[model samples]
Target: MSKVGAADPAAVLKSFSSHLIAQLESRPVKDDAERAAAIAVAKARTESTVGVLLSAAEVKALVAASTAIGVTVRQDFGTRVTDADFAACTALLESRALDATLALANTKAGLSALRGVVAKQGAVKAKLDELTAVPVDDALRARLWRVLEAEPFDARATVAFVMHELGGADVMREWMGTKESTSLGTHTEQVIERYAKERAFHDVKAPPGVRLEPMLRWMLTLHDIGKPAAVEHGDRNMQHAFTTPVLVELSKKLGFSEREIGLMRAVVDNDAIGETLHWNVNRDLDDAAKELRALAKEVGMAPGEFFELQSLFFVSDAASYRFLLERIFTTDERGALTLKNEKFEQLRARVAGE
Candidate 1:
């Protein structure tokens, strides 16, 4: 029976829907894929009904996996690039001479000298194919190396291409199989715009080179997958911990090193520590570091690596929270960090208990 005089329009709609559903004819699902998709949606609806609202981060990660990782079928699934893109990428890499234009310098000796390097590159690519299951082209490899090698640190080329490959603006709750910690928008350019500026991108640093910047940016996007502090249901760090398997799954697909995965976890596992330290001021810097060092050890990072990686992670993360960390600490020429402050008072409130 419909509620004719219900005070709420929504109550009337619900009564009408219940009556309508009882009269609807049953239909079989078209196929297994459709059936599975329906099941997944039903499960998600049930969960959302129970009130742990799927964080934007969780949805982003799941959607990327579904689209690109073969977890679910999509109408646009087979849109990988063809002919000229691959050819051009291949030609540029093989043609560009280490010395300038390999073709021009080709005495027999010069060509002979380059053979070993070329062969070694081929061997590495073959191994990469076996590991990643995507017969990635030399062009993509060279471009990624170039991005990592670019001075002043840029990843736009690779990130943009990945955005395209992962459905670009269309499917991007996030593209590239990761989610942003803020804004939860479909675009990632906004997040990139917010990142702090530092010099020394790829153009090849002697030791601690441009790799760190891109890696940090890439994984920071993963840090808050399901971790929106505003509407989040539970502990943020714990939720981050719950998402580690998803992180590790994506990390393995991307060919990240174990050390790098550990760094990602370190950043996510303790993301809010800086804010807590600033607000409470119960622990001094040394005392606070002891807590973080323990976390670094649990993640199997060296104290040195943790100190360097997490400090950068801290300042970058802190800027949004106004934790006053970026105010004092700064990175060196190589992007290694140092807390170059004599003023302890700056880290805490101007007056105690104020």
Candidate 2:
């Protein structure tokens, strides 16, 4: 019935050591002196084991817990534990446990150990959620815009900043875990910036009174929001494009008009238009053009405007994957996918004529 955090480190360590001694006592120790020696060694080993796994924040929490229980822990582990010490002890323990566990046919203990590891992961995720739960407001949004302007290439951090502003840090973390090499935030940033530059240069057409920049930004930001949900539930087949409804609902709550939400959702649904163009350009130009026409109709965009928006995203998305551009493009030296690319130019001409 004792509270978990109320115990001092000395008491906790003592209890932990006692548990180890009890487990050891079941083993074939020779005499009372041997048992006493075993207990002493076990205490040192147990302390050395847990000390290495604790992070700086966890160590600070443990120290505070110790202080609350009237026990000083400053001199106990030299302020911090070394990684080598922890790793060595952990390897020893794991080797012993593996040997013993493998000796038995019924591997319930091994299963239990796996479950414990999973439980620890859950605890870490909970802590992350708590730490990232900053309230989204106008101030946070402004700060995010400033950071995006200052560090345009730091897409991951900028996207994290935006997610944090939208109160979606947990979602962002899940998405980030699934995409080790990809940066949704950076891709979105590049897409918006590319759209802006194109709109300034070309006669990219859109509906009357519709601001392209804000619409593109909103679309790109929430385009991949559903990715985390798809990843979390083991739904590997779920297309992230289908998640635009979530963003549409969110925009409604944020006071965006129905027409604005429709435009954003259209962009999201057609976000992968660039990928299709990239992969299918050589094999079936006519097929690619037909697909674009259908996507434009579905998203309620004119064929010309739809092609322009999708081309902007296509070029920017390719640019964002600079490291992987060689894999994406066949004859690219600098890995820059520009409007001058023959395939892209061909697609543009075909769409413009339509």
Candidate 3:
């Protein structure tokens, strides 16, 4: 028998199918043939082959079971389960169960529950704990990548992945906060989506060797990772820029190499430079150009590459600012960074060297 309270994927699937069949049978179908046809139709609609009519209570129960194992069900699931719903729930459970099981397997409470099963299998508790402690499942990684790719701009999804997959949601929550105005998580998501849209519009490409999309997503996602620590220390003057070193170190624990971590750090640091240049656009053009060149060197980017990076970061960051989004980028043209203010116009001219 399986360990008590352990999430058995097969059992879960069986239970769901049973509940669905029961619900379908209770419905007003004239005959077994009619019922089978109805079930077939429901199954066709769902990505899951076993799809059938489900009651509201059944849907809720399925969702609760999935959630217990750390799977997030975003869809309503309705009174009937679709193929898409089944597939989504199944995938979620499959991925989340591995991590949850591994986490549970490493704990004392988990061991106590598993004592009977382990004794039957002649497994040593210490060895089992050691095996499960690492918790590095490739399937989980793949699922998270899919989530990021599909919902590139979703802050909640991003946070959920980092917290559940990477094991640090509480810390991330402190950094992100609840309000949009002060939330680092909100700002990061806005920057990533805006940057992505701008890059595609302008045909801006990433540096030759870098995988641009994933790199940008990872960089922007963790750019403000150090904010909570800064705030905790009462360092009101702390900018996310000043926390690059900390971020770089923390990222190492997340499996980033030195080179990758270095690139991320440079991007985070340069974001501050972009912010400064953005604010000082109406100042001397020559001075701005000089600073831009210096900033480029500091980040080890060529002049042209730096310009592209800065423009992407500046525009994206600006778009996140409520004041700037409303007052400065006022045009209705999609993907156009039109400036309504004279200062912004001057800044644009300087950046363009016009």
Q: Which candidate wins on TM-score?
A: 3
The model with the greater lDDT, 1 or 2, is: 2
Q: Estimated TM-score per prediction?
A: 0.39, 0.47, 0.49
Q: How well does candidate 1 match the true structure in TM-score terms?
A: 0.39
Candidate 2: the clashing residue pairs are none
Give the root-mean-square deviation of each candidate in angstroms.
Answer: 25.2, 22.0, 21.7
Best by lDDT: 3
lDDT tens readout by residue for model 3, 1-354: 111122542234344442233223233334556445444543443333333444554555644544443342222244565665556445554565655444545665767878865563322233223212335566865665676567435656766666677655554656443234456655666776676666655544554565556666677777666566556646633545335654565455545556556656665665433334355544555565666667656555565566666666667767777777776665546746755555534444454456
Candidate 3 lDDT at 201 equals 50
In model 2, how large is the Cα lDDT of residue 50? 32
Estimate the overall C-alpha local distance difference test score of candidate 3. Answer: 0.53
Tell me the lDDT of candidate 2.
0.52
Clash count list over all predictions: 9, 0, 5
